[model samples]
Structure formats: C-alpha cells, structure tokens
Target: MKILAIASAGGHWVQLLRLKPAFEGHELIFVSTKTSFKETVKGHKFYSIPDASRWNKLKLIYSLICVFKIVFRSKPNIIITTGAAPGLMGIIAGKVIGAKTIWIDSIANVENLSMSGQIATSIADKSYTQWPDLSNSKVTFNGNVLS
Candidate 1:
C-alpha cells in the first residue's frame, strides 16, 4: 500500500513517527513542515511544506496548495496524520483525491480531541482517539501510537 504520512513539527511529528512501525511493509511517504525533520525520517520519501496555523489565514492557504500538489503527485492509497494544521491539510487533500484517510488525535489531548481532530471526525475514513473515554459514534479508541 502507498501511505502518505503527514504531521506538523513538534509533538504532532513525534506522535506520527511512533506509528511508523504500524506501516511496515508499505511504501511510506512523509510530509512535515520543517526540513529538519528529514533526519528523523531518513530512508523514506519526505516532503516539506510551509508551516501554518488556523490563526494564520494566508499561510494556511499556501500550505493547502502545497498539500494538493504533494498528494496529487504521490497518489497515495492512504493518508494518515497525528496533527495540527498541516496534517489537517493532508486529510483534506486526500479526501479530494479519493484517498482513504486516518486521523489519530494526539495522546496529549487527554481531555478532548484537538480542534483539528474534531474536524477530521467528519472527513477522515477512520478517526481515533487515544483516550478510551473520548471514543464516540464518530471516533474509535483502537490502540494508541504511544502504546
């Protein structure tokens, strides 16, 4: 399977990396906002997009464009993210291209899903919450990346 794994820098990137083992035997392509993350995902295909936040309207638009281009060229069968804005952009682009998407809410959101996670619940083919208590009709609690 061709998998496009995307996440922003910092905690989201760390959490996304932890799921690498789960994607074993697949053709994994990674996308992050920082070029510095290339070292962490050595030996895999990696792409860097501009970092943006919900608060940054202009940059977010540019990031979305980058996501469209990457997703189009990669032609992944699946797209997965433990996210922030950049991850959400990947999910949106994946949806537009008819690729399946999985959104794993960060373990740090112990109390509730992040804003991006909540949005992903409606768009992602599968949406997961690390906390069992947060599971609902739209989101499932399978296993966590941290575990």
Candidate 2:
C-alpha cells in the first residue's frame, strides 16, 4: 500500500516515525514542517510543507494547498498523521481525494484529545488515542508509540 504519513515537526514527527515498523513493506511518503527532516526519513519519499497553527488562517490554507497537491499527485491508498496543524491539513486533503485517513493523537494529550484530534474523529477513517481513557466509540485506544 502507498501510505502518506504526515506530521508537524518535533514530537509529532518523532511519534510518526516510531510507527514506521507498522508501515513495513508499504511505500511511505512522509510530510513534515522542516526540510531537515528529509534526512531523518532517509530512503522514504519526503516532503516539507509550511508549518501553520490554528492561530494563523492564511498559512494554514497555504499549507493545506501544498499538502493537497501532494495527495492529489501521489494518490496514496492511505493517509496517516501524528498531528498538530499540518497533519490536520493532510487529513482534509486526503478526504477530498478519497484516500483512507488515520489520525493518532499525540502521547502528550492526557486529559483530552487535542483540538485537531477531536476534529479528526469526524474526518479520519480511524482515530486513535494513546491514552486508553480517551478511547470511546469514535476513537480507539491501541498500543502507543512511546512504549
């Protein structure tokens, strides 16, 4: 399967990378906020889009456009992300193109799902929370990446 794995830089990106083993045997095209991350993903296809947050509407649209183009061109079978803002953009883009989407909420969100995670439950095909307590009918609690 061709998977588009996207996340923002820092913790989101690190957590996304930890899921690499699960994507073994599939083609992984990674998207992040930093060009430097291209080196970290090594042999996989990598893309760096503008980093944006909910506070910046303009940049968020620009990043979404970039991600949309990537998803449109690649036509990945699945899309996944450990998110902040950019990863949400990816899910929106994938939704437009009919690619299955998955959102794994960051391990740091203990009390509740992040704003993006909450939104993803409606957008993504599968949504996961690292904390079992957060799991409900919409989001499932699977094993975490940090463990």
| Highest lDDT against the true fold, candidate | 1
Q: 116-137, model 1: which lDDT tens digit per residue?
A: 9999999999999999999999
lDDT of predicted model 2: 0.93
Give each prediction's root-mean-square deviation over alpha carbons: 0.9, 0.7
Give me the runs in candidate 1 sitting further than 4 Å from their true place.
none
lDDT of 2 by residue, 2-81 (tens): 99999998899999999899999999999999999999889999998999987889998899889999999999999999
Model 1's alpha-carbon lDDT is 0.94
**For candidate 2, what is the TM-score?**
0.98
* All candidates: TM-score: 0.97, 0.98
Q: Indicate which candidate wins on TM-score.
A: 2
